[model samples]
Target: MNQLPEDPCMQEIQRLRADYEAKRARSNLDSAGDRRCIRLADIPGTISGDILRLKQNLPDSVDHGDHEIIGDKVRPILNPPPPPELDDDSEELDTILASLPIVDVDSSKRFVKKGKYKSEIRNLLECEG
Candidate 1:
């Protein structure tokens, strides 16, 4: 009697079958309703308003105090301040200075008298050596 040997096509079918089974198992493990959506709806609109008010009142570097929920349980939440705005005049100056290269003006202009000054300096250095 002859038996069928495992081939590339059979391997591919087995891989697909395993993937389908894994997906089915995951679907079974998932909750009936997504908790994230439910949690978002449960959060009070007043809390969002408080966050906006806190942001408007404080500078970027400033730290807002922890939020405390009073009642049955005490839950603390931290809120950070918004980023500060850059001043227009200082920002413009920074941009302009960033574009320029540093150079020594006196050294560059010291040899302005034709090519004579450069040649003289070279000769003086040669004699000294």
Candidate 2:
């Protein structure tokens, strides 16, 4: 009678395959990671739940872990701070205007030549630099 050989390599491969299968199964079921999110049983939290369920599940070579629940509950949409609050942009404008230093305008106009305007601007830029 010929006895089948117990290959260590095959045994190791089987062990790894089993381990992967187990983790994949666990990932599909378990979602209680960091945050406690309300999971819908009907819906799959993961995109590839079906693939994971299949016997030929892809190998976890890419270190692709299951996405954990982000939040405890879905927040209710608030009726965004009254419409008036949004419409009242004048307050912001007023605040900006108030922050600006008041400048006094001299009614007297000393007309400088058009050519002088460029020189004056260049001089002002040079001074600033």
Candidate 3:
């Protein structure tokens, strides 16, 4: 049986889809190139070889031990001797803190007191009666 001809609209849609896909692929590659990170796989063989050669040429006298660069090891903190002036400074600070008024949160006034409003309402009702 003879195949039906593709609709012109469908053909145009397919063409546009193909063009979009091609553009998307190109943009992905372009964005990948824009990234700051350089993958080891992407590095040129000659450049890697040069790096290896440089590492090999480094003198043994220059300790290239990874352990030499001490990592985050747990150690007891050496407490520094307390300064003689520290006691005086702390006493002054304590006096200043004590001088500041201690605010009583319970004594603080609210914008609208419930008891005051209720009394006013009762007074109004008594006057109306």
Candidate 4:
């Protein structure tokens, strides 16, 4: 069979195709450690209805010993506790105010004249109010 020579452009394209296939195969092999098959059902909190269904199916008499313990440990991480409440009697506010830089009398007078000192004091106590 007399086969005509392959076109240079077609030869170049075939070579590129082979290179691309090799790279794709290597990429798939390299990504084997990744959770490539993870679905919505596999992720926690992704399907709230399924969780509710599971909870409903479980009998009240059954002890969820390990599950409860795991949930307790995970809950704080998912929903962190609110910061400690600052009351009017809290000394933290006083401590913060005391930590402010102390200016000399002349600068303090200038700040007072421009109402900058009062504004700064008000800003420091704004969160408390």
Candidate 5:
């Protein structure tokens, strides 16, 4: 026996199927050229007016020539050449120097003895006196 759909899910499926069939029919009709075609009579006069307005809005003179000079005769007074490229040996030397391990030195060993400062301060005081 055929039973009627009672659930919301079945109702939604039926609605989607109807919409799909309607779209397919419209597409087929459009492809068959049965739908209304766009004719010159349908175009408004405002389109021609817009084209004339765009042409009038453009600049009168457009300077599109090359501004840069080439060759030996047109030598640049202040322009400088690019820096020379470093050779492979120089690059390797730089990498080797950069990778070297650094040595930490003790500054306390370089400091003058306390007795030496005491004698210098005494001599300065004596000289002032």
Candidate 6:
């Protein structure tokens, strides 16, 4: 999950979220205080006109790129590379097994039943001698 995408553009987009979050944090820090707020009622006429003009200048929403182009662009996303053969932080099985502490069990040691549990015996028929 920590690895970047193959496409540089995607990598850039992925970074944008974190970058924007950080910038937002810094902006908040810089503007900390009630004094920094711009009240809508307090905004003078000229700045408000400029804001209106900017809003008017914005183009109407239009259909994006052609479907074919869109499909092509999303193909990589739709079909991603197979997951890594092994995770980056994962140790090799051999090394992991080697690192594990060995527990030696004595072959001669045998478990004996005790307590309330006991083996059941079947009655055998007695033969006339």
Best by lDDT: 2
Residue-level lDDT tens digits of model 5 in 39-107: 111123343232222311111121221111221112222433444666543222343334435545443
lDDT string, candidate 2, 1-129, tens digits: 222337666567667777876767755344334322222222244433433344332233312332222222223223323223244322224433443355554322222332223445456456757
The segments of candidate 6 whose C-alpha lies over 4 angstroms from its true place after superposition are 1-4, 29-129
Ranking by lDDT: 2, 4, 1, 5, 3, 6
Give Cα distance to truth, residue 88, candidate 1, Å: 78
Instruction: Name the better of 2 and 3 by lDDT.
Output: 2
lDDT of candidates 1 onward, in order: 0.37, 0.39, 0.35, 0.38, 0.36, 0.32
lDDT of 5: 0.36
- Shift in Å, residue 68, candidate 3: 43
Q: Model 3: which residue pairs collide?
A: none
What is candidate 2's CA lDDT for residue 71? 25
Instruction: Score every model by TM-score.
Output: 0.20, 0.21, 0.20, 0.21, 0.20, 0.21
Steric collisions counted per model: 0, 0, 0, 0, 0, 0
Q: On residues 2-105, what C-alpha lDDT tens digit does candidate 1 reach at each position? A: 22336666567667666766655544223333221111112334533333323112122213233333222224344424435665432224433343455454
**lDDT (tens digit, per residue) of candidate 3 on 5-119:** 3767656766866676665654322233221221111123343332222321212321221111112221222443333443322222443344335544432121333332344
Cα RMSD for candidates in order: 26.1, 27.7, 28.1, 25.5, 34.0, 27.8
Worst 10 residues of 3 by lDDT: 65-74
What is the lDDT for 27 in model 6? 41
Q: What is candidate 6's lDDT per residue for 1-129, written digit by digit as tens?
A: 233357676667667766766655544223323322221112334433332223211111112211111211211133334444664553335533443356564332323432221111111111211
In candidate 6, position 111 carries an lDDT of: 32
Error of 3 at 54 (Å): 42
Off by over 4 Å in 5: 1-4, 29-129
TM-score for candidate 2, residues paired by index? 0.21
**Residue-by-residue lDDT tens digits, candidate 4, 14-85:** 687667666565432233342221111223443323323232122222222112112212111333344456
